[model samples]
Target: MKRAWKVSELARAEIRHGCSSNPRSLTHFLFTLKKSANHGSVRDLNVDADTHSSSSSSFDSSALFSNISRLFTAKSPTTLSETLTEDLAQEVAQLRDALARNLHDSDEVVRVLEENCGPLLRRFAGGSAIVHLLKQLDSRPSLALEGINELISVRWLLGSSFSFYQPKDFNYACKVLNWRRKQEDCEFPMTEEEYAKGIALAGKVEKVGLAIELFSEAANKQLRTTSTYNALMTAYMFNGYAHKCESLFWALKRDPNCSPTIATYNILILVFGRLLLLDHMKLTFKEIENLNLSPNLSTYNALITGYIRAWMWDDMERTFQLMKEGPAKPSTSTYLLMLRGFAHSGNLEKMEQMYELVKDYMTQKHNPLIRTMICAYCKSSGKERIKKIEELMRHIPEEDYRPWLNVLLIRVYAEEDWIEAMEKSIDEAFERKTTVQAIGVMRSITTTYFRSKAVDRLATFIKRAESAGWRICRSLYHCKMILYASEKRLEEMESVLNEMENSNLSQSKRTLWILYKSYLSCGQRNRAAQVIGLMCKHGYEIPMTVLPS
Candidate 1:
């Protein structure tokens, strides 16, 4: 027996209130009516029939019909016209169903929309109905692209904004490139610029697989131009596929149709430099000169970076000098590299010289550099360099309140016995809620105090950090215990464990291991056995290697 369809009470109540104002109800009602048109009886219109009919509500037929009659009579034209009347509603339903099935026939949708929908309807179409349709086809990007582009075209025909939707924004360009490769009779070929941009996006997102696919698609389509080749090579280099980049570079060089540009050689230099292949890196630079291509600022930076990484200091200096004499002068980045190189090599005087030159150009973006310079000064013996650190600290804006920088400053001040300065920095960080990322930063400060054996100070800092609402991690608590154990202050170590217990912290195997090691080191075999017993109680596996012979 064929199941007879009737209007669901939910649909009835919706229509009674004003089905024209509700799209779901309207679509449901229209779909129901269309289904009934093919049958003699409208038995039940359980709109979400697929979800099940038992959950649907029932309403008084007479009351619903009374309200619906008034609604239609009062505003028949206004309601029906605005809400996609019967004919247009059928078209939308068919299109949505077809799109859901991965059908790419946009002509019917576009035609129906262009003929029936006005500017207002077209504007709302993309965000409303089209979005729902697109959701069904997200895994199929080519279909999604077609749907979006066709709707965008409809909007253009209706005298709407032409540039409202950019296909590039969705990162679906790679899918389009792949799709184009399979099409034998190309209606419209993708340009080189589009392929280049798609490859660049792939690289930016660190998607090496997509980058390779896009490149191969372009290559198979015979659309491998210089721009596309360069983009692909860069993607490989930046994503740590240096060997692949090298192979691509050689291929580009041999390709009679395309020649390597200055940009291409720069990529090769960077690849070779990062791999610490200085001979190849230098050879690539020589090739750049041989080709009469002027080395850009990026080229020089890559070469210097390579030299620094390889610790070829003398050669790095000579290259910098040659760069200074050449057309490519040092940029802010170049000076930063020099400063960092000097800092690492303990050449404090030269580091200061480069700092002065670059400091004026340094913005908030260069905070990492400031931290590096401060660390370098702290490592040196001269107390006078403390003033240099102070000057650098002033450059960091108060509003930024970078937690990492605050913790670093605390370590510096604590090391110098400037207790007041260290406390002030800590208070500022806590009050500003900057210490929320406390684990890593707290470890840095704790490590500084532990290394100096400043037990009192370490305890005080830990107390302050906890009181300020920072979660005192197990590791931080372990640091304090280790410090006390090292001093052979067993009572204080026990007190720390009690504090942890009061805080509802549980002990782990590492905790037992630390206790066992500490007791054994202090020549207390009895205490080590107690730790092993506690491990057993906690259901932790006891390692026999820690047992006394």
Candidate 2:
């Protein structure tokens, strides 16, 4: 009879063979040892006819077990708890080394952690490796801040639920570690590049308050360079904090180490223009001149835009003349601004003249200028000009044409009383799912039909819009109510008002006033009082002047 081999002997033989194939397979061998210790069993072995066969097999199994034991003793822990701690330490060290190499290379750090180290750390170190890596980076302040930033961005991309560390914590760690150079030796604790990058990152994420905090920190450290100030100003501009931008601009002027660049002036001019502060725009322009700084194309564009917004045409024209004589030539934007101004003022002659000057330079096939000209022609009832505009628009690709242009064309066709053409345009816009344009066209068509007293046509168009999945806005209902009042159809007007309420569309103050007036005209005094009450319920206070005497 051949004695059965123990399960421990079989496991030892399997681990020996595995280790022989790969001498460095320490972890694999250790796992097999653990399995054998946990579930030991015996298996019968067939004895060979040769007398020496059983003895040889038993000797080989014993030697294999001895080798495995020696290998484990050399490297691995004796107990399960010790094994886990040892594995975790190895994993944390590996992660720490990988991150250290990628300290300055943020992109590489992200790639390595996500690809290689992340799984290992999660399995062995339970995600605490990330905290350890951050602390290691924190030890070296030069790379600490940037490393933390990259890790945070990576964690966000990875959708990690673990809260490791934050940029603010890194800042605190730097102070606590005394990582910053001695104040007597270094003028500023953080370098200009560090400050700029930190502030810009905050700005990129639209965290204006955080950006301001970073700027304040740099300022407190006496690191207010021109670039630092500009960065803070840019953050303010992006956040639409115009007043903050102005305050920083003046503060920059007071700083002996910093002087306002032309870019700085350009930003200030833009803010002033947007606010329609023509006086401030002009003063900033004069400051540029007084400083002997040449005004660029942007500077002139700012002045023109400010004048146009304020409706100071005379000043706008004077600035245009000055721009013509200056070294900085007007750009396409400058031409567009002038064209828009002319369009708004109903100066077709100047609009034509401006178009002729820039026609060759208008490289964009579907330019805003074309849209502006088309709108102007529609406003002026220029039927002949429509054909010319259409011909020009033909050069633009179909996709390049803005949806509003289609709405404008619909309005023009409606004004011309070409009902078939207007309906065709509406159908085409709806087919294309040009939602915004479709809504505008629907509103315009409804208004036109009401004005023409074509109630039947208006009802058909509303049905068409609804079938096409457009939410008819409150303005449309208001138009319908006004039309009903005009026709002395009190029942229809009440029905429209009830529909509006069911749609959860609140009546505007103007709508309420119109309803009140209509009720008074119909000699329904009680209903008129009810209208006033509805207005108040909707948060509109009734003025004494509007109340009945």
Backbone collisions counted per model:
6, 0
Candidate 2 local lDDT, 1-549, one digit each (tens): 012224323433343223212222122111000111222211111011111212111112221121122122111112223334666667657765775676566577557555754364334321233333333343343443354443444443222433433454333223211222222242213333345444544453345665666677667866555545656775675567889999999997887655675656766886686677888888999998897776766567667766765668888888888888878776555665676567556688898887776565454422444665666777785558667667667655666645566767787777666677777777777878765435565567766776677765665666666667665787677777777788788788878777777667876898788799888888889999989888878888888976767
Q: Whole-model lDDT, candidate 2?
A: 0.56
TM-score of every model versus the real structure? 0.48, 0.47
Off-target runs (Cα >4 Å) in candidate 1 are 1-189, 290-293, 397-407, 426-549
Tens digit of per-residue lDDT, candidate 1, span 256-293: 76666665776677668767799999999898789777
